[model samples]
Target chain A: MDRLSVPTSRPLTRLIEALNRMPGIGPKMAQRLAYYLLRASAEEAQTLAEAIVAVKEEAVLCAICQNTADTSPCTLCQDPTRDRSLICVVEEPLDVLALERSGAFKGLYHVLHGCISPIDGVGPEDLKVRELLARIHDGEVQEVIMATNPNLEGEATSMYVQRLLSPLGVKVSRLARGLPFGGDVEYADEVTLSRALQDRHSL
Target chain B: MLGGTRLGEADRLVTLYTQRRGKVRAVVRGALRPRSRLGGHIQPLSHCQLMLTESKGLDVVTGCQIIGPLFPMREDLVHHARGFYLMELIDCFCPEGLENPALFSLLVDTLEHLCLGEGGERVLRRFEVRLLDITGFRPELHCCLGCQQALEPVTNYLSPSAGGLLCRACAPEQSPVHSVSVNTVKVLRLLREADMETVNRLNLAPDLAAELEAALRSYIQYVLERSIKSGVWLERLRREFGPNGALGGPQNGR
Candidate 1:
């Protein structure tokens, strides 16, 4: 049965349809959220709407790293205390946030925004790769750490970048693979376990 | 499976090719988290059996088991690129919900060959020819498309725009045609008709392999009306690593 045909009020139906379009939200969830908003105070609804609008209106892609920021070049790119000699390359702005949350990497970042995925018609030219190369050519960067995801597209993107950086004579490396923190080794997949074993370190 | 992207925090949108359904996109819930059982069975280039539940838009993958992960392809960069290239070919040519068992088997066979350490150039050329055949875009190799005469055991022209080979006498009429050697012609014919087992036994000279690759790539580009992305990456790998660098050394098995 169509959620739109539920005989709801016009404003309520509109809200349900809009919420249904969001990721991971089904018609049932959309309707539930719509009802919650319908009963909430007007100020609560206005604040939510305003936050969405503010994000779109205020967010800009940082010039150097291509991450979303309120200001151009972003705080990470402008920070003089951060190590500029090492650049960690990642696939998205969200990945930068995840890495930052871990607090393990203190180097600067270059967000490619996406990986090379032919299934989606995304290629090297479609990504921010040219900007990355330009940065390397114009800066004093020595090592580039490929921190793309562990998926196939991610691996390919890192390899693609590695090949391009090879000609520039800069040291290029990928993030070490191993068991995640707090994860049991017995439950790990064979591929990940094998990679972790191959990349094991000496105490 | 072709590949997938992380959907939400723990879910994934996976692209799969099946014998019954040509290509499918499904959502696998909790595929990203460490304890998710579905994560190991759906890696890109992996062949798997999936139990899906039909939803409003995309199907949901409820259960999965790995049939073949093609793990070696992932371990090596060149093999990995070639594997992705094969998947991209299917993704580009095959439409969703259309049944194509032959194409599906061809893909599985090619990936299996790659897993066995078969040279990528040979496997890719064979794959291209078979793909064109299954898709009804097989180019005429025995005779000229324009003059309709049997091609001689000499150099000929392959016209991508004309969709087949042209005799030397008729070559000038076509605005653009690639000069193809008789050896390349014979090899293409063999690949189109032979099984993977038979094709695997044959070894192509490097020059012939290069010629065959160029001709088929041009033909495929014309058919799709654009160049394939993986083909561009393969060419880039060739240019950067030399012929043997990324794709591995040429196999000369008789």
Candidate 2:
């Protein structure tokens, strides 16, 4: 606790505590990080600070896909080079990284940011699902890939999205098995994610 | 812990999942009272018919009757650790509001198998494989990730990172690979294809058992995204039993 008791700003203390709670980073690491930031040159520190601030200020939720982006239409949504017909829906921004790392998906993406959980009082309305439907309402998309994490919430979210999208007559596919069991999109290798994307079957 | 909380008493935490609701924590009122029937049924890893009183945010458990208690799970450390592993995985993997009969049945059957004397290892392996399938992380056991051709039973590398077998045709492309045997592939297939009851009946040799353990560990590492405390404890448990690994004496059917 003493190491964590930084005689600095309240915001710094709070960030340290929050970072400490994150998996893999211990209190010491959190404190070191906090102290390093405090000691860092103003211009260098501003780069990190500005990036964090810009995440909220510059990034707007893509009106169509709901992924955070500088533009209302995210790069994925805007990209004409990618498969406009295929939409890979995921739970969070990190999931986008996971898919991208796999070098497999060459399509648009929708970030739900969360899954439905009655226990947690998180309903479909809590997610960016309406925007997803709005995209489908345009009637050009051919396939919807439900790449929510392979966990309960992820499955439930995908199922909900699938049921919603199915009524619209668009093909809804799920990632085929090949990703590690219970593995998240973030950790999956390029090979596995690519294969899973290729083997995706209609739900 | 047995769940119950009222204005007069302290909070009691109980993990719950119902057909109507998914996984959640609720408190019961007066469950600890000596006269309370709720205490009789509300125990860890016990199957029960519970009536939930839907509250404003968190629900309350009004009543419950013991459907079955996984008594054998607690009797031994290996079974206990395994049971905890299943419960934690189910708790973490399953989200709230989703009624997956598949996951529920898998949990119940796997617990039942763990209680039974025969083939605990096989039952657990089968459960892990199926749990992944039901959720969506189905391993590509049939072929290599790159070439798309079928890999011979033992000719592929089991890469957790790559998500499945890396056939020799495509192995050079994938750098990190785990050496996998034909027996391992067959056992994994048996798990994927067989029902829980059939899976519980298979007799596993030491080598097969070790292979299964390795495969499952990596698979879990891939999916769970984080480590479970019980997993670390399980390693210690097996070491305590013997260097050969988690085998109980004749009575527990290690």
Candidate 3:
């Protein structure tokens, strides 16, 4: 009820509250960041704000891969050097980057964005799934590599997608599994994930 | 419901909407060509408010307003795999054409956990089990399904085939039951009751996680018979994380 309680800079406090709502950031960290931004040089502070604003405004979603891009088609879909026949379906845009970093895959990708989650209530329709079927239809997509994560949701999504694409008569394959370049097989699971590693024969 | 096809020389855009079978997808043609209007903004995990329209029985994504990139599942292979696994599980359990509100919110929250924190594997496992529970395949975790005995301090005996605990008296007669602690059973029970946000906040050690995983896998396998292909890869991926990172690496039967 006093002057301190009725702070003069309510807007600043409110901003901190908003920042605190972000993932991994707590009230203390948010407060510290808010203060840091406030004390920062005007140019630096303004630039940070602009960067945030720019991603929201300037960035766009590529029409093909559903990946975030500055332009429509995105770089990977446009690249001539990549293999056009292979289509790797993944759960999110970042998966493209993860596969890219592996330097193992040369094919194009389809970003499903989210997988089928039952408890939380996200079904296949909530994801970019149907477009994937359409991709198989029009594109000369010879082989579809399902790159969904190896969890229940990812497996269900992959299986559903595989079944959907099966009618199209496409060659649907999963990623190779084994002990990573340096890993153990003893700690595997009982389902297909471990079995894949156990049965991984030499190419 | 988000799906895409190669639209241009280097561009692609996907449209998502509620599907008759519970998901939908759309493509933007020529979206990848350098000169095309749709560029890097539409890749996986970009949460954008989109402008969409229906044409030729498909939902088309006309435009997008970027919200910001979510980075948790994108930062590495492990996180990526974990996220996909979570999403796919939700997909498998939901019925087509039904707008499952809890599943949708679960996905958003699951991704939020994946991107913002560590221990994604545990969070994911808990989610998987919870998904099964909600979807109605909950294996009886508490008392013995056969004996109807009160499972206090759950002394090591879960029969996947039987779908619940097997007391020592019963274990000798049946195939060797998987061993799980009372604490682990409590955790499983908790998974059945707790919300995803609450589930994500808890700690799940590797050994306990391994026990729960075996019991859960066995129960699911007994029901489904054949194994899910993704389940195998998930095991290998878990091994990749090392023992410290191993919440529940493979070792289903081993």
What fnat does each of the candidate structures reach?
0.30, 0.00, 0.00
Q: After superposition, how far is residue B126 of candidate 1 from its true place, in Å?
A: 0.8
Query: Against the hidden reference, what TM-scores do the models get?
Result: 0.82, 0.52, 0.47
The DockQ-based order of candidates, best leading, equals: 1, 3, 2
* Clash pairs detected, candidate 1: none
- The 0-to-1 C-alpha lDDT of every candidate, in the order given, reads 0.84, 0.70, 0.63
Candidate 2, residues B1-254, lDDT tens digits: the string is 21112323433457775545567667666654433445435655667788888797867778775566665664454665666667667776787668887778778877887787556666767888998888888888888888878787554687777788888767777756667788888888888989756765677777768877777777777777776555555565565446333546653442
Top-lDDT candidate index: 1
Show model 1 residue runs off by greater than 4 Å.
A1-38, A78-81, A182-187, B5-9, B19-25, B49-63, B95-102, B135-137, B145-148, B154-164, B168-179, B193-210, B221-227, B239-254
The total of clashing pairs for model 3 equals 91
Tens digit of per-residue lDDT, candidate 2, span A71-159: 87777777878988899998898789889998988998889888754334466778888889998998889999999754334555675
* DockQ of each candidate, alpha-carbon based: 0.31, 0.01, 0.01
Which ten-residue region of model 3 chain A has the weakest summed lDDT? Answer: A184-193
Per-residue CA lDDT of model 3 for B1-254, tens digit only, reads 23343443444445342312345556665554323333334545444455667778655667655553554444344454555555445445565456655655556666676666544565666666766665667777767776888776746587766767777677766674787788887887787777656665667665777777777777666655655444555565456445434322231111
lDDT value for model 2: 0.70
Off by over 4 Å in 2: A1-203, B1-9, B32-35, B243-246, B251-254
